[model samples]
Target: MDVDEERQRSLKRSLLCLCAAELVMMVNTTAFNVALPNIAESLGAGMAEQQWIVSSYNLVFAAVVLLAGFMGDRLGHLRTMIAGLGMFVVASAIGLAAGNVPVLLVSRSIMGAGAGVVIPMGQALLGILFRGPALSRAMTAWAIAGTLGVPFGPLVGGALTATLGWRGIFGFDGVVFLAVIAVIRMNVPRTGGSRKSRSLHVPWASVAMMFAGFTLFSAGLVNAQHGVLTAGAWMPMAVGAALITGFVLHDRASRNPLMELGLMRDPSFAACAPALMMLNFSMYGIIFIMPAYLETVLRHGALIGGMLLMPLVVASIAGARMNDRIVSRIGPRGTSLLALGCLAAGMLTIGAAMWWPDGMMRQSTVLVGQLMAGLGLGAGQPAMLTWAMGRVPIGQSGAGSSLLTVFRQFGSIIGVGIFGSIQSGLYTAEFHDLAQSAGLAPQSAGSVTLDFQRAADMTGMTGDLMRQAASRAYESAMTGSFAAAAAVIAATLGVVALISRRTPR
Candidate 1:
């Protein structure tokens, strides 16, 4: 074959391999949402532990992403991606077969590490394979694969859970992971980049700092539910603050820092990072909390909740396509501001709907609000990422993009942990107050609390009183959580406004 034909064939194969890898990684992050309740039941997890199921994955994933990018630069993207895929496959198998919660957590953490390796390197490889419009289109396709995977995950996951069980999702992932490896091996070219003499070290100190900071913050939020405060919680938070301070200084002074601190000093890059962070924070919060609301409040099954989320996914895809057109016209700054406004408005609308009396109408109103939020998220995310990278030099694009990805994932971890805590706290407090107002004895109230917790584990309540109490507690908790999430989104809007105003137009 001629050179042109060979090049076209090579590009097609590489893009397909990249798309498969992207899809698997995205699915790994999102498919578990549908299984969370089932997982909790099986493991007998409380609110905090359940939150860890998601946060643990995101925490390790985000923490390691920067280092993964550095590894790709030194060790070759193809090699890094293949190794990640292998780890992902092993982790998936472990998760699928594990009988205990700790094992599952370990499996998830390993999966996150694998994801860290695959995603950044995959993007870097795409950069190597294509250029100009072809490159842009390829990258856009990757983004679409990843974003749409969130919505699609529930559909696939829910169906699998309904048909087979929660474990099926992980088993499916394992199979898909192997498929990705095969695709990469068969199709992707083995290209080599420069091996700079950068640190092969994993920056354990910085990782520990982030881990401590997030853990303390998450513990504080979780403790808020029990109406309890202890030194353990606050101490971690203080240490976290200190560690973060030290981390910043370390990054600045290190020859090859985990992150390039100087890039953050750029006003445009700085502004975009927070906006992207807030957007993902809100996105994951809704994803994490909405299913519970549907299951407990609306009396829907996992499949139904997944279906209800479909519109948001569809709107997001439409919004992402529209973003490409508008970014050139309004520029990234204006487009982002507009998107943020839409997000804030959408969140406020949902919050207002939650204040309505519980009914079908209230549910409908909230779903509308979700669609609006999804639209804003879809438009804002692509523009923010593209704009953030665009402002930096081509050579630094990987680092810049990786930083944004890290912050976004960190936002996801924080969002889930905080919102889960808020929901748990609100539920516990209101349930106790309601019991008192109903003239229940103190001993009876304690029994009711035990019953409620047990009801979450088992399928049915043996007594009418227990069922009624559990239902009230669950609804109250979900409503309070949604309201708090709305406030968080509102705070995000204010933050975006301040940041965008100062961002160079």
Candidate 2:
């Protein structure tokens, strides 16, 4: 083949492989939500354990990402990605054979480790392979794939779980994981990639500090269920804060910094990073609450919950597709403001649905809220990426981009932890109040509060009463939680509008 044609072919193949692999990884990030109830039932896990099941992967991913990036720089991005894929496959296998919650969590943490290695490495490889227009197009497609996978995860996961049971989801992942590995091997030529070719280095101390800091902070957030101010939550959070403070000092002093801290100086970048984080923050908060709410409070199956979320998935895709056109008319800042507004509005609408009696009107209202929030979140992402990256110093774009990714992950972890804490606390308080009013033992409230499914399964009027109380508690909790999330986004939106300079037509 001619050199030009071969180069084009190679680029196309590499881009295609990267996008598909990334889609699968991103899908797994949220897909496991569909299996939580079933997993809990089968393994006898409680609320805290279930939360960790969803959390462990994200925790591990945020913690280990820099180390993974360093490995990519040393061993070749493609090589690192493949090894990560291997880790993902094995983790899926472990998930399948696991008999207990701890074992399952161990498997998920491994998958998170895989994600850590693969995603950053994939981004690096794309940068290495493409330039200018090709690079831009590759990144857009890459971002879209990631965007679609998150909501799509629940859809695919639900279908798998409903048809094949919870283990089916893991089994399906294993199959797809193998296919991703196969596609990369078959399509990408052997001549591609390098081993230790460049001098991009990350210090081991920085890696350790970052991982520990992120992990501890998230762990503290996990304990926020007890109370954000309580010792269980605050103590760990204080230590984590200290460690993170130490990390900042160390990074500033070190010659080989893990992140491009300088990017924060750009007005657009500073606004863009936090704004994108709120998007994930809102998205993840909704994602975390809905699955448990559907499966536990409403007693719907995973498949039903997944089906209900279609409006969100569809709207997010539509918004992403419509983003460029929206930018052309209103500019990036307006588009971003519009996006956050929709998210805040959509969340409020979802919370409002609980006010209605159980019927079609309630469900339909929920769907509308999903559409609004999904559209806003989806619409803003492409613009955010393009805007932030444009301001990034050319040679340091990789580090800048990685920092943003870490930010997004941090947003996810925090959203889930804080929102989960909010829901749990409110649910328990309402349930306890009701249990006490009925003259039931406080011990009864403990199980009822922690495990909705168990409380729901008890026999007679007592069971029915607690069930009603549980449902009402969930409704009240979601209302408060959703409103809180909206308030945060709205406040952020206002700040961003003030800080970000108007985009030129």
Per-candidate TM-score against the hidden true structure: 0.89, 0.91
lDDT for 302 in candidate 1 is 74
Which regions of candidate 1 are displaced past 4 Å?
Answer: 1-13, 127-136, 190-192, 196-202, 227-229, 438-462, 500-505
Worst 10 residues of 2 by lDDT: 441-450
- Per-candidate local distance difference test: 0.71, 0.77
lDDT by residue (tens digit), candidate 2, 357-398: 866888788889999998987787777766676666444544
**Model 1 residue 486 distance off true place after TM-score fit, in angstroms:** 3.5
Model 1 lDDT tens row, 1-505: 9999999999988988888788767666766887777676666666667777787788777767787776676667788789988988899889889898899999998998887778777766766666555665676677667778777777777787778788898899989989889989989987544566555766777767766666566555555544536665566556656766787787678766777667887767777787787777777777787766665445576778778778778877777778767776887788777777777667666656756665777778877887888788778876776656655554554566567777787678667866677767666676566655554421222222344455455444334444465556656666666666666766766776676676755
State residue 1's C-alpha deviation in candidate 1, in Å. 7.8
Clashing pairs in 1: 225-425
TM-score of 1: 0.89
Candidate 1 whole-model C-alpha lDDT, 0 to 1: 0.71
